[model samples]
Target chain A: AQTVTQSQPEMSVQEAETVTLSCTYDTSESDYYLFWYKQPPSRQMILVIRQEAYKQQNATENRFSVNFQKAAKSFSLKISDSQLGDAAMYFCAYQKGATSGTYKYIFGTGTRLKVLA
Target chain B: GAGVSQSPRYKVAKRGQDVALRCDPISGHVSLFWYQQALGQGPEFLTYFQNEAQLDKSGLPSDRFFAERPEGSVSTLKIQRTQQEDSAVYLCASSRRVDQPQHFGDGTRLSIL
Candidate 1:
């Protein structure tokens, strides 16, 4: 079974600053997907960004980006020019490739991020 | 609607009672999923549906939990003999295809008293 780990339980960043959330996983499969999800106080889980294990180029979405290190089993999310809207509970999730019979997404405990104005 | 929709944004049920949560996925989506999110924890997979077929349900905690998508669009997750441990947010998501990125609903907060 694959499991995701988010070492940081809580984090805070000042407005317009940058912050990175750590994430690691254990899996035997070489090809898979890693995703970062943001859950606001509204209880809406939104996908921040995603990265494919086979792609060496990191995934970047607007101010949200990811540093995916397949060999190190680490996938960290970086938020640049952070705004107050970035405050939320961030989760790291892992999912197997299409070939896998059951594509169940495994999520980590999560990290609460606070953006200070 | 433009996104996945879940009904009864909040639900409260007494211990040993039964409760049902509804989810209406985006039109034409081929995949639907249900997840349970405990406070301060990440959402955990509960079950999945491919159109009208239930391909996976191993993540369900127990047999007391049942889910179905009869028309392949709307889904229902029913819990029998609810317990305090079952209190959590139930999230519903849908994807264009099995391998596509899924969009989640606001989720229904279930409270067992």
Candidate 2:
């Protein structure tokens, strides 16, 4: 079974600063994918970024980037130029390639990030 | 118009009652998934469907939690004898392909009283 772990329960950052949330996952499969998802007060699950196991380069989306260390099973999210709107709960997830046309995702508990004014 | 949709945005049910949550995936999407998200937590997978066939349901916490996707497009999650612990936001997602990034719906908030 694969499991994602987010050690930080809560984090805070000043406006215009940068914040990083740590994530780690355990998986025996060699082929899989990792992702970061953000959920605001609206309770919508929004994709933040993704990293493929086969890719060596980290994935970035605007101010959101990931530090993926496959060897350590570590995948972390970095948010630069943090804004007040960035306050939300961030979750890390892992999934294996589909088998029989279906796949299940393992998700972390989540880290609540607050952007201070 | 292309995003996933979940009906009955919020539902309140008395304990021990039955409830059903619906999800409509994006058009042409071949994969649909059901996840449970408690307040202040990440979503947890409950089941997966490739069209009409339910291929994986190992993450379902109990036998009372059942999900079905008929015709490979629309899906439903049914909880029998709902308990207070079952109160949470139920999320649905779909992807174009197995490994593609999944698009999610706002979710159905289920409150068990």
True contacts kept of 2: 0.90
lDDT of 2 by residue, A11-100 (tens): 999999999999999988888889998988888788999898989999999999999998999999999999998999998989886542
Worst lDDT run of 10 residues, candidate 2 chain A, spans A97-106
Which consecutive 10 residues in model 2 chain B have the weakest lDDT in total?
Answer: B39-48
Alpha-carbon deviation at A100 in model 1, angstroms: 0.7
User: Model 2 - which docking category?
Assistant: medium
Sort candidate 1 into its docking category. high
- Number of the top-ranking candidate, with TM-score as the measure: 1
Q: Candidate 2: which stretches are off by over 4 Å? A: A99-102
For each candidate, the alpha-carbon lDDT, in order, equals: 0.94, 0.90
Residue pairs clashing, model 2:
B51-B72, B52-B72
Deviation in Å, model 2, residue A63 alpha carbon: 1.2
Q: Name the 10 consecutive residues with the lowest summed lDDT in model 1 chain B.
A: B94-103
What share of the reference contacts survives in each candidate?
A: 0.79, 0.90
